[model samples]
Target: MNPNKPSKYLTLVTEESRVEGKKNTERNPKNLRKHLSSIRLSRKLQSGIDTDFYEKITKKFLDDFYPKKCNNPSCEERILDKEISTRPDIIRCSKCHRQQSRLSYTPLMGLKLPLYMFGVVFHESFLQFPKVITATEISKRLGIEYKSALKLKRRFQLFCSDHLPKYKVLTYRALEEEYKGFKLNPDTETDVAPKMGLKPYVSADACVLYSASQRANKGRSRYRYGGLTSSIFLSPKLGGKQVGTLVHGICIQNGPAFFESVSDTKANTIGPLLVEQIPYSVPLFTDSGYPWLYNIYKNHRSVNHSAKSSEARYKLARNRFCKLSVHNQVIEGSFRLLKSSFSSYCYIKPEYSKLYLDEFSFIKTSKFFGLDCITERCFGSQFSWEGRSTGAREATVVRIGQEKYPHRRSSKETKKWLIQAIKDRKYQEPEREERLRRNKEQNKYDLNSAEAISRSRKALAGEMKRFNDFWSDSQKSKHKRKREIKYENLSFKIWNSIQYYKESSEENPTVQFIADKFKLDKRTLMIILRKWLKYGLIQKRKLFNKESHDKRVDFSIVLKSDSLPHLLYTQLPKNKKIFRRMDQ
Candidate 1:
């Protein structure tokens, strides 16, 4: 049935219905495509106006992805053309006689466009548009109205957001399908990623993004949440698809951890934040900003650079050989580059930081995998959106210039600019005298300084051992502090034990718990408790109304460790009187 034709239920398109016909097969009864020869196919392919080809693609997509059986909630019957009496393309279920269109139960069920057109639009949406292809390109490629093309692009982008997370699994499936049955040649490029790309030790750093909603022409400036902070971990020498590619993990949290509330990134809050991300088995390479990492993990390396000037820190990092032997240079450089990209995304909401971080993560991972600047596999459909207000792409339009493609300029452009600069007598370029001197010095070592280089390497290795010793020695003070608390008096231990007893609702604290805490025998603790109770300083209640059972103490009488000792010393009599009272 033509959607434009007059319907029994409501008014729509002005076209009238033709004679209703019965169908008997799945493919079209007219064989509308048998006449399309090879020459005509080639011409239509060039002309970009082939209804028959698009229809074939649409039909194939529907058969593969959509439910062909009855879509009615109560029915479970196969739909065949013979059952469809009115519409040839639409079928009725054999059991319920309910009409079932190809778009039934899908988001496109009530759409006015032909199934083929919508199929192309959806395919483009998921695979091509917004990033790879624009609305203008889509309209030109599909040979559709500009309005229709723009609308389709928007609708498809929204749909992709709904199914965005599935793209990862789908991308993996696609890779497998593309390489299925091919022998593994063990090439260095592909083998490198698996072997060297999986790094355990990684450098960590964070950069903030100031992005905002771009819906209005000029949106509000202040968001309740602060700017987005992206904490990135980079492993440059990790196993990758290529020999030298890097892999990374990221977190968006504790934004603007300075001058903020308790939840911000302080030592106490940062420990829990980073400990959960890094596994215990992996060593952490960080700066002293994360001091708690030393306590939280078994293996970690941090260099104290906060006291040093920025230039001094840079010089220290550039040395390549250091006493600490731990550097965050890789992640530090990444943060610097990432900060430059934040200019285009200056108004980001703090809560949506993770989503924004994922965009960068995908781009970097794509480079690692040698995926040519495509974002097809960045998102997966398995995850749920945080809320309804999100998912509208924050960056609908971004200006890509020299900032994005800094190295894309050709030699001609460089020479042109240089010649122009010289003619204008503007010496803006840096003097290469120091750089040439370093290169000359390095080349001499490259030629015959092997013995000197080896000696220097050994000396540096020895320095690393010294660094480790210093690091280990620093932990002794921390250990001493821990021991001081562990040796507190029995009264203090009892007060701590009583706190546990008061907090628990079910299993009451046992007599043995207090004894174990203070390293005292259970009998001695009981004797002390019995003496206290006899002196009218404390009281005990019968368990389950049984006089022969366990006893419960009145926690209020001995409130704190300081007060308990004062009461005992002031009210109790001398030891000779205590002994006489005990004997009696």
Candidate 2:
């Protein structure tokens, strides 16, 4: 082959073929149908003349609010649908003369928008489901104010958040059908057997919603004067800051998922949350970062994403018999979809982060239950007007009011009342002065009494005694000295054990082995190992098991070259025997 020419392995494509491929991708029917459907829906909503949409929404409202029979016991007449058609908002019984407002006691109690327009907002919000439609887009489509559209959208999300179910699981047959060729059912009884007491595979992980510059001013003063002030300086790197809200998610394969905003990703925080959200019998899948899960759950498994090829081969062989893969890719892909849905918003505030998470979680749970977003389960019975009052509705509506002197008193009457009040105040001044002077004299006499003086002196002496005792150096120093001696003795014993291990075996000793030999707590030994590793006195190496072929991680401690010279020179009596046994 010529050195300058293209090799046989490499294939070159012309610009014409590249353009043709692009055209073919654009001409795909599925893509065309999606875009066209969205456009048609938006157009129909914006036109505001869809009578069928209005009728459908009105029928639903009537069905939710209409009583089965008339409220009057004497008549016992059933309210027919024809009698309810004159007014969409009010349902009337023809015989009993009873009337009811359709929106009363519901979420739409005092909705100001037209019935059809409200239907449009509802269709865009819940009917669309997982696809995010922002309030800005809704406002543009409905020709409404941005604040109105935002309030409408928030109301729907709040309803879903309050009513969404918890910990929904799919049937084994459903799971098997969805994930073909996977042995999800552990029971050998029957295909239609309930999944009760069976362990389902769950994947848990944490992800960031979005990142923002920590140095950015998140206050009203940033835009007070219509522009940024010169006194406030911002660094080019934004103070080397990247802040985001941590959200933890648990996803079941072909089933429901749960997400919540978390303050920290520590073991204590995540461990309790996982136990609360997931059942104890389920199998958990996560990455190697969550080693603590092994102790908490009985069926916990994880994959070493950062392992070398040899470690990966061992993991593969170890997990070859598992019913499900050992990776957490299910929840990882869920995080990607969640962040993509959140891309419609510029930024989500940490305070409102739970609402967004709950909204997404509700949608996922609804899909698992085979429920539509617009069904009565989400909108009708779940929504209430409890906290919302008539005053709140009145506050949103603008009205003209009296500008000045709205009270009953006229301007001349108010002046006369003020004069009378001033005269009354002057008349009582002399009596007020006498009373205040007498009280002051009484206070002075009380303070100078014998009992008061003695009480103050004793309190001062007690305070001084407590202060001296606290500041005394003898007690604190004695305790400090005792602690120092104890710590030094413990440190010496730990170092001696480490030196013994170094001499007895050619291979580095594992932390567990050393802890077992010295009869030390594993956590305390780990702390000491961490300190030694930080100081460069020892190095840590990951070793795999060849005897049992298990995937459990084992870390061995190796003495650094520079620190080996400083180890204890004393040798143990059993060192020779241990070395010979290891050589065998």
**Backbone clashes under 3 angstroms, per model:** 22, 0
The model with the greatest TM-score is 2
Best by lDDT: 2
Candidate 2 clash pair list: none
Q: Lowest summed-lDDT stretch of 10 residues in model 1?
A: 254-263
lDDT of 2 by residue, 1-584 (tens): 42223332233445675576556559885665655554455444444445455557645643533233467887665653334556677766677668766654343445566566556655555566567778898788767799888766665455455445322322222333433422222211223123323333578988776643323634323232211111122232344122356688988654567887765455645776776666554567787667555334534566666554347445444443223346687798788888888888777665567767777887766655434323332322221112122322221211112211111222343424423322322211113344334423321110123442344435333433332333233454656545533443344455544554566555677877877766778665564565456445577787788878676767887777322111111121243331221101
Off by over 4 Å in 2: 1-51, 58-83, 91-97, 126-129, 166-200, 214-243, 309-324, 372-584
What ranges in model 1 sit over 4 Å off?
A: 1-47, 71-97, 124-131, 143-147, 165-316, 319-584
RMSD to the true structure for each prediction, in A, is 26.0, 25.1
Estimate candidate 1's RMSD in Å: 26.0
TM-score of 2: 0.44
Poorest 10 consecutive residues of model 2 by lDDT? 563-572
With candidate 2 superimposed using the best TM-score fit, by how many Å does residue 114's alpha carbon deviate from the native? 2.1
